[model samples]
Target chain A: MILDSIQRVLSTNELVTAFLFVGTLVWLSYLISARLTRGQVHGSAIAIALGLVLAWYGGLVTGGNRGLADISFFAGVGTLGGAMFRDFAIVATAFGADIKALKQAGFVGAVSIVIGVFVSFLIGGIVAISFGYTDPIAVTTIGAGAATYIVGPVTGTALGAGSDVIALSVAAGLTKSVLVMIGTPFIAPKIGLNNPHSALIYGGLMGTTSGVAGGLAATDPKLVPYGAMTATFYTGVGCLLAPSVLYLGVRALL
Target chain B: MVIYGVALLSFCMLTGVLVGDLLGEVMGVQSNVGGVGIAMLLLLVLSNLDSRKLKLTPITEKGIGFWSAMYIPIVVAMAARQNVFSALSGGWMAIVAGVAAVAASFALIPVLARFGKGEHQ
Candidate 1:
């Protein structure tokens, strides 16, 4: 009976590697941060490291399958990359010594995010229909990821699309990271969104939205805690609903 | 300086992903390898960060903004998958979800803040 239970446990572990992968990476990141930096390393750096390791192991364990490894590798890297760039942009704005300007930039950023979400969803929906793919999970995962450029993996997971979700998530994250890295600094100044407070608002919203998406996409109730923790720590609560809004908006049109 | 930071971070992140993928392909170690790699990198980066003077004031507000922008897409993607909008047969469901999340944050953040302050006190 004990052997049977152990077998069951091992099977369960193999079946649900997602949670394990994420959890292990996070824990490892913390351990590294604490041990190497004496706890001074930035959380973003830890996240980046965790992502890289996950991608590497994900590939090797999956048996030299590039496609298989790509999902986790991309998701982890894209997420860390996005966060890092966003943080850098905000830090730059904060160093500019202009509170009023920052506030304006923040408001503009908030508005732009709202618009970006809407537009991305529209495009994603069209892609789903055009491809003749009706797998709700795939459609939603790919569509959402392609549109908003974040939280695609979580949505993919919730939809039961497996590693593909991670792949889509990575794709979306890359898009957003690239855009924000290139666009925010140049546009914020013109639009007066360069103040530190504004950067805070923008960053908070982004973090919150990612958290909410992750929570909604979670299949296991246990993941909810991790999702919430990620949401709260990585993103602000304000952006949590962004995923749902975009999803439904597109679904409605369809 | 910010651009440089962004570039460096991006490069490190990209390198981490590529290395993780390569290692996984060669050894079949899986995502666990990526996790391990990240742990190693964090240890190295942290060691470097520890020697620098850490300042929270100017970066705090900016940090908040940066996180907010980055997170927006993530939430939007989640909502899209929830099909809450599809089940409800309207866009209002999405709006409701979004509002609820925001409301929950407002309710929860202050409590968290208080708890954090209490710890210090």
Candidate 2:
């Protein structure tokens, strides 16, 4: 009777179960991070990677949308991983810095945004070409996505690219964001990303605000504002450039 | 006091989302634009309002501190929800494009740093 009751309670409280599940995943990831990677790779990065693996497996097994959240028991994963909490966490991280420090990197931040957008666009565009995506719209959309996830759809919609190509653009940008978040802490020392100015440049160059913000938060919370500020500008600059000057540039080349 | 911190964050988030949605509508995009970024800015501005009367208590500061460090779990959950496998299965082009773009951008950091004036380290 007690066993049946426990099962009923566990099954009913989905969100609680989700917390328990994600908590354990995080615990296991930290253990692996400490023993295997010797703490060189942050626990958060490992946790995210493991979560992605679980998501892939969940998709394979269920063959349903919403990833692991599709399973009844894991149904709460959808709400737990939804945008509301994501934005809440991001806002929490933003509380760690000072606005006064943001003023120190003005000119460098602007230059980084322009150069960052162009470089990412060039690299993404070149790769798209090499991969046989010869259409200017496809190349431009993906190239803008390489700038940031936000810019990708904005560019795609503005250019009237097909839905599939726009989806690809979003995926490309999401991949970039995850990569930046996971790679930041490991590369911080080598890149001299220890200051506000460098953080500003890094933010602009990286262009994805969430990626830069998360990466900087992991590496040094104090630098989040500087990096996030320029990264924000990067998206605006990308949206302006991608569908116009950048798209025209691609057309000229193609 | 802790409740106040949560209240402050909630207020910033609501305002940010509204502004982000408005901006998206203005820009003709169908999604909220820069909501989190705006929320962060709001928190920064509100917390540092430079008024002696408005200064946060230590308990409220601690409350904010607690939530700030809890971003890891949220990030993990967000990662779990992304359908990366399907996205990758679309083709090798998407993977190559993303990885190359981030890699090339990373490589340019030092060069850009040199041109950006003093690091003030």
Candidate 3:
């Protein structure tokens, strides 16, 4: 029965697997969060556990071929979402912040994600067309998971075209993760961008841009700590709802 | 404070999931757990926050608002691929879902904000 269940799960498409991974993460996150809330666990433990699980599950899902990239992409998305949500919370709760601010932030974050995804799609399409590629024009959902987790792989998948998009996305996500880790802190300080919230946004944009850039330069591992948190949070939210939401949106338009 | 943050987040998520599930069961609506979690968290956080600082520069506020609106269309456009409106029996159902999501966020924020305040008093 156990073996059967494992097979059933593995045989399913990437979306179902993505959902299962997220659901598990959410549940684990809740457990960790609960422990922290009860003063039973340190925040560092939570962070470590998150990183470890991310690495492990990411490897498991993407396998040896694209595991690192997939892990990085998903982690990036989650970190971005979490950071945005955290900012919204902080703004909403801060003595000087208000409903308008909260509303505005939420709006901005959501819109940014939409714009980002659309832009990525447009770029992917143009690249495919200019190169005389014959892949499906529709945004590939398989890579979306990797893209949400690891931006590089998604970008790779986008530019790599058709059959190898998954592999390309995975490769890209890993490379981007490394770059963002190295660059965000240094760039942030130089650019006068500070604070955890801003750091999160900066990290996300870096991850996104790195995915666009592919494996150009070596990324720093230190930024991984910061970017991982935000990426996981956003990726979690997006992965969970993207399919249902996308389905609804497309149906309405057609 | 960290413990409290974790506990509150957990409670909000659990409550949101439960509430969303109950509502889904009763109404046959397909509300998302994450959305509920977000709404609940917002409510809890906002309620405990001081009301005086709810301000931002107009430009910043506008930027945020625009981003928030941007997600809706992407989600809607993607959802359209699934024939979501037809499943709802009409476009009105989709509108209703959108309205409910927005309303839930707005209503819960203030109500939760008040509840958090009452606890302190």
Each model's lDDT comes to 0.37, 0.78, 0.34
Kindly list the per-residue Cα lDDT of model 3 for residues B1-121, writing each as its tens digit: 2344334444444564566456544643333223333443444454455576633345533433443332212111111111111212223322232222222222222333333235445
> Which candidate tops TM-score?
2
List each candidate's DockQ score.
Answer: 0.03, 0.57, 0.03
> Residue by residue across A137-176, what tens digits does model 3's lDDT show?
2233322322333432333343343544443333323322
Q: Write the residue-wise lDDT of candidate 1 on A159-247 in tens digits.
A: 46667444644454433332332233223333333223333333333333333223222211112212222222231111233245555
TM-score of chain B of each: 0.38, 0.82, 0.32
Q: How would you encode candidate 2's per-residue C-alpha lDDT over B11-56 as one tens digit per residue? A: 9889987897788668755556556667788898899888998798
Alpha-carbon shift of residue B58 in model 1 (angstroms): 14
Which 10-residue window of candidate 1 chain A scores lowest in summed lDDT? A217-226
Q: What fraction of the correct interface contacts does each predicted structure contain? A: 0.01, 0.59, 0.00
Identify the candidate with maximal DockQ.
2
* TM-score of every model versus the real structure: 0.33, 0.86, 0.36
On TM-score, who's better, 2 or 3? 2
Q: In candidate 1, which residue ranges exceed 4 Å CA deviation?
A: A1-96, A147-150, A175-239, B1-121
